[model samples]
Each structure stands twice: as C-alpha cells, then as structure tokens.
Target: MKTYRIRKPKIVVIGGGTGLPVILKGLRSESADITAIVTVADDGGSSGTLRSSVNIAPPGDLRNVLVALSDMPQLYEDLFQYRFREEDEFLANHSVGNLIIAALSEMKGSTYDAIRLLSTFMHVEGNIYPASEEPLTLHALFEDGMTVSGESKIAKTRKKINHVYVTNTNNTDKPKAARKVIKAIEEADMIVLGPGSLYTSILPNLMVQEIGEAVSKTEAEVVYICNIMTQKGETEHFSDANHIQVLHQHLKTKFIDTVLVNTEKVPENYMDTKTYDEYLVQVIHDFKGLRDEGCRVISADFLELRNGGVFHDGEKVVEELFRLVFGAKY
Candidate 1:
C-alpha cells in the first residue's frame, strides 16, 4: 500500500464535472485538505429528466466527483456509473448513481444530507458541496439578445457566452458550506481553478453570488490553470490571457494572484491528425504581455494527454502546482 502522506493544507476547488475530479485525484497525494464546490445547473439527459420529472437536484456532476474521490473498488464505482443500456423502460437512459442519489435525498430529507451519506459509503477523500441548496437553473444571456436556460443547452449552442446568472436571483439558500470545505479554503496554502471548461466547468461555481464573494475575500493564493486547447464556439482563438480576461469580466473583481500556462507545444504530428484538426486551438499566452497586465503567468510543461485527447499531464500538472504552492524556484 502506498501510505498516504498528510500535507493537509486547506485546498478549495471550485468547478463541476470531470475536470475537478481529476485534479482531486492528483492532489490526494499532497496531503492537502480538499473541498469541491460543484455546479448544479444541469438540465439535460438523466440529470435534466430527474430535475423536470422528479424535482430533485441534478446528480450527474456530483456523482462523477464522488466517484473520483472514492476509495471503493472499481466494481462499486462501475455500479454507480452504470447507465441503462437496453432501450425499453422508464429507466432506459438514466444512470444508476443519479437514481441512488435522488432516492437518498428523499430518504435523508435533503440533498446535502444525502450527499454526506453517500460519500461516507464511498469513503470519499474530501468534501463536495453544491453551490446552492435549491433545485436551481442557469440562465445564459448571449450578446445577440438571445437567452438560454439550463447548463446543457448553453454548452451545446456554440455561441459566445456573454453572461450568466441563476434563474432565481433573489433566492438565497447558499448551501451551508461543508465544515471541512470552508476550513480547507481558510487553511489552504493555495487554490486552483481549472484546467476545465471555461464557462461550464469553471465559472458555474464562481457565478454563485455567495461563493464568488467568499473567493474574492479569501486570502489563499489563487491560481488559474489555463486550458491548453480552446473549446469550440465558447473560446475560439482565446489565449491564456483571454481566459483570465473572461473570468475577471464575469466576476467583477480581481481575485486571481497567478495564472499557470503551458509553455510546451503539442507534437505537430498528433495535432495534425485529431478530429476537428483545423479548429485545434493554441494559447496566445505571452508571458510578458500578461505580466504587463499585472497578472503573473507561470509557465510549465502542460502537454497533451497521452493516447489521443488534448489535456494536461495530470501528474506533471499537479507536481508543478505543488512546486508553485511551496515556493519552488522551478
């Protein structure tokens, strides 16, 4: 057994879906305390179905994060991830995990309580909190006077996301911070935002009024991990600085102390063969230019994922993050 060492720095991660979980898996080794603030605006597929028909918090993203942090064997994780395959009945497309969470919420009398119960069963290494307690919606306002609601739709539209807000702007049921989550942030030596989708995975948590305000006021050194490639439509031609610019525009405050960018380039051969190759994006990341704007851009070896997809090397990325946090001169 690889004995888990405990660095236990209070680390608060704000995002939703696959990206945050991958980061959690890497950071687990650093012994830093971890908290995940996940977005709950999903309104598509099994998540949307449950939300519309059953009036429960969307469970897909939350389930993914839970599985990511779990110490349970792959069998249980597979069961949690199993989606209906045979196309016949009411449960056809829904995930078993989503139903389990919904059922647990009903039994426990609250979604938050149900999550705690489920996490305990899974032996999740860290805490996960929804941005808000209520069954809420995401509203997207595009520059063309068009409006879209729900996380799924906005994600698919391929349009420039102008701004976002919760549907019930007046609702104030900030999900009580998981005791450990707040403590993680308060004590975290560093907090990282991204390598995730800009609008969907990254900004959704930040859109929450209370969470955003708290992040702005927190003293942890904030780092924005810039994505290596841009998402089509949302961040076409966007550079490292462009990503931070969009974030600052949305938040209306400057909370980011540093931005980490990939200094290495993708292998030309691989880039030429990927699907949608022409649309392959590169960072307009100029360190001097970012330094001029008063944001320090830390360059690292952020490379394309091995075996095909475009993503950062998880171990390498997190290792660099460790160095940056502990003030390694690298």
Candidate 2:
C-alpha cells in the first residue's frame, strides 16, 4: 500500500528592521517551509557604517533574521547580537554578527553567497535571502517635492513621504532581486509582508523592480501583518488602510489578498517614549477603507506589549496565517 505524506506549507516573509525577525521567530515553531526576503537598504547605525566601509549589503537586518531562524544555542545568539561599548574607539557600536557577515561577504565575494554559507554554519531552519545581492539605497520623495537618499535619514525629514524606491548602490544598474527570490515568491503558498516600518523597511524590498513584479504576478495569498502603532515620521495620522494603500500604489497592483489588523486598544500613556520614540499612537482602524482597497480584513488582538512598547504577537499572527493557508488548501 502506498501512503501519502503531507508537504509543509511554503511561507515567504518580506520585510526588514526589527519586526521581520519577530515574525520569523514565531514561524520557526510552525510546520512551514519559511523563506525570509530581507531588505538590504538600511543605512543606519552599525549597518550604515559597514555598508559605507566595506561596501557590502547592510547585515543588521539579515543578521537578526538569521538568528531568528537558526537553531543555534542561546549563548551563541547572544554573542552574535552583542554590540561593542560606545567607549571603544575602533569597534564601538558594531554587532559581532554584522562583522562576521561582512567578513564572510568579503571572503565569498558577495553578500548573497556569504549568507547562504552562514545559514549552513548557523543551522538556519529556513531560507534567508537579501532583497538584492548588493547594497540598495532607499530614496524617499516627500510631499514637499524634496527627496531623501538614505533609509535612516528619511524619517528625520519629518515630512510626509510621497513614495519610496530603491536603487543599486554599486552603479547605474537597476536593483534586482537576489537569485531565487522571485522563485521563492512564485512557489510560496503564502506571502507575509510586515509589521515593520511602512516606507523604510517594507517598501524598500518591494521597490526592487523584479521583486515587485513577481509579487504582483504570484498566485500565493499575500497577507500583510499590519502595524500595531503608527510611526511618528513615517505613518503618523495614517489609518491601517493608508498603509495598504501605500503598498498597492508602490506595486501598482492590489496584490494583498488579506490583512491581519490588531484591533485591541493600546492603553493610553503606556508607551516608553524614551526607548521607542518612533512609534506614535495606535494605528487607527479603517475596515471600510481596507475593503475598498480590496483586502480581506482579519481584525484581532494581535498586540503584545513588552517593556512599554507595542508589537505583534507573532505566534498568534502565525496561527492565523496557517489557518488561512490550510483553509484554502482543504
């Protein structure tokens, strides 16, 4: 007698910053074949320094995502995430993992190859692909017609972002997806966008022309994990629908099939502004607007407040995602 074995669901998560790893960590516990497509446009802090000095794709986001998906020991993860003290002249503020990735990129001749090799060393349970093989520069055109060139500097403009795009930092060539990025999207059973920054973290990845095109053409159910709070310089006063609108306008397609929104109220005066100053208020709901934009809304209490900061409860979000995937499969 022949027996049939069920295949694991393929989930491709696209985004960067701190939020992508949160979702990835939760998905690591699930029965899914995960692929994390991380943005390489970051130009801030340790990442910016490395990108400028080594001319490599920013490793901070990729490093975090790698740790999230890896089965490495807690001590090893801690060491990788450790940052040098500010007093240190040469090594100040650089993470150990970023340095390792930079060194590996130099050794392998490319960031793409470095991450693939590191994934094996780290025992990463899933695929981690940089949005582009080379470093990308995020350009944000603000409402005032002025444009900002770097991801870290965009928010400092304090002006409304009209739109965002990416460019290859190497030369005049167009930014393209790292190899197999489009293939991952094409084969995915589900594509998760983000609970990250709207313009800087998420849009940077989608702005890659080939990636944007593949996402628009994919048959997978594209789900966006909506932000729990509005970002001060990015999406202040923006409703949940506004976020989706920005994504759709960037891609030139209503590609998102579903959105998971956090309807639970964040308690007033509960945020620790000193630590999480970028986040403003709770993201306002616009179910009608979401529907108007052709998105199936899944509103729930996906909020997880920690140390006075609000974020998505990844496990709950992943559970909903699996339900959606299996629901369609059956």
Candidate 3:
C-alpha cells in the first residue's frame, strides 16, 4: 500500500452499478481520502421495488459501496449481502443490506441520514453518499428523438441515446445532491468517473443540477476511466472518445482532464455472453478524438478477465490514480 507524507489525496468517485464498488474496494488499500457519489436513479430489481414501496433513494448501489469500503469481517459483509431465496414470497430476492437500508430510511425519515448512520455501524473508511436526497427518475432522449423514462427501461428500448436528464420522482422540482456531495467534488484532488454504464450508471449522477455545476467549475483533475466494452443498448459502436464525447455533451463542458484507456485485447471467444449480455464489443480506441476533446490520455493494459467477464483491474487502476495524484501534487 502506498502512503502519502503530507496529506492523503482526496478522491471523489462518481458513478453507480457494480463498477463503483470495484474502484472503492481497491482504493481502500491505498492511503487516500475517498468519497463515492453513487447514482440513485436505479429503478430495477430489489432497488426498484424498495424505491416504489418505501419511497427512498435506491439502496443497492449504496449497500455495495458500503460493503466495498467496510473494514468489517468477511462474515459480516456476507451476512449483509445475503439475499433471500425466491421461494420466500415476502422477502424474495431482497438483500439483507437493502432491507436494513429501507428500515433505516423509514426510521431516520431520510435516506441520507440513514446512510450516515449506517456508515458508522459498517465501519466504512470513507464517505458513501447517494447522489440525490430524493429518488430520481432518469429520462433519456434517443437520437430518434424518443424520450424514455426510468433507468431500468432505457436500455430495454435499445435506442441510441442522445442525452439523459433526471427529475425528482415526487414532483416537478429539480433533483438536488445529498448534502456535501458538491463539496466533495469541489475539494477533491481528483474526480474519477466511470468504468460503468454511460447512460444509466454514470450520467444519472452528473445529471443532478448542482453536482453537474460543481464538476464543471471544480479545479480538480477530472479523470474518466473509460469502459472496457461498449454496452449493447447504450454504446454499441462507441469508441473511447465517443464515451468522453457523451459525457461532455451531457455536462455541456469539456470538464474531463484525463482519461484512462485499456489497450489490452480480450482474447477471441473468451467472454461468456450468456452471463454478461449487456456488453457488446471492446470499446474502439480513438486517441485523436480524445486529444481533440482536450483530454490527456493514459493508455495501459489495465485488464482483468475474471469468470469470463472483462473488468478494470482495480489495483492497476489505483496505481495509476496514485501516480496522477502525486504527480499533480509534486
């Protein structure tokens, strides 16, 4: 593990889904003050069910993040992650952590407060914040000008996405970041985006008005860990630069300062498509396009193929992140 002499670099990681936890888990071993701003726009599976019933921000992402950063024993983490068998009608498919989060949200009267309380109990080393105080409905406008609402349904449409925005689920009001979310972005030495879904997981968090504004103005080095694979419903033929382009288009600013791109190739017929169907192909690299967008590209063989799935080697990514952080500081 690498340590900082003066002060630990503050890293604010923004995005949701399975990818956020991967990055957080790696960051746990490094000497860094980490804060994760996870998307709450999910309306699928257990998260969606809880959001509809309890009216709290989706807890699935938050739960995963908590587990990722927790210093608790493996058994405790396993217990929190345990999901009920589908045979149990009332508790079917609900993770224990999600249920706990729901109960806490009800007891505390807000999801944000519930998470803060849970952080203490879970022994999470860093901050884990829901992107918004209220549940948000993600709306995507496709290239064909068709607008689709709900994160769960957007990809199902298989339409080309033009842009996406969020709205407070309960009213017409704009969705606001949970307290301190913007402050984390402002104070961060570096802001890391993605290794997750472009439209659903990553963009939804940035779509929060204040969060987007803060990112646009923050002096921190904004780094995008471009996805290893183009998503089926989202970025079917997208190059690495296309991913960056979408982010810039959504925020209406060229805020990203650096991009991490994977150069290693996935061996032919290595991925099990049946298990990981959302991914289409390796994200085509467009170095010129990335340079055109004014981003400093860091290309490497940061690949981790596990159980026939392609993922970012978290430790490798963290090594590069530390180099960037210390390089910028010194």
Q: Whole-model Cα lDDT per candidate?
A: 0.74, 0.93, 0.93
Ordered by TM-score, highest first, the candidates read 3, 2, 1
- TM-score, one value per model: 0.87, 0.98, 0.98
Instruction: Report lDDT (Cα) of residue 240, candidate 1.
Output: 81
How big is the positional error of residue 275 in model 2, measured in Å on the Cα after superposition?
0.4
Give RMSD (Å) of candidate 1 vs. truth. Answer: 3.4
The positional error of residue 101 in candidate 2, measured at the CA in angstroms, is 0.4
Q: Which scores better on lDDT, 1 or 2?
A: 2
- Candidate 1 lDDT over 1-330, as tens digits, reads 233444445667777756677777877756656777777777778988886766667888899889877889999889999999767489988889999998987788666788889989899988887766666677778888788877778856777778876754235555343334455566667778887878777777777666676677777778888888777656777878778778888888777888888888776656534554423566777676566556777787877565555666667777777777667221
Model 3 per-residue lDDT tens digits across residues 1-330: 556567889999999998888988899998999999999999999999999999999999999999999999999999999999999998999999999999999999999999999999989999989999899999999989999999999999998988999999989887888999988998999999987999999999999989999999988889999999988889999999999999999899899999999999999899999999998889999999999999999999999999999999999999999899889865
Report clash pairs, candidate 3.
Answer: none
Inter-residue clash pairs, candidate 2: none
Q: What ranking of all candidate models by lDDT puts the best one first?
A: 3, 2, 1
User: What is residue 253's positional error in candidate 2, in angstroms?
Assistant: 1.4
| Candidate 2 TM-score versus the reference | 0.98
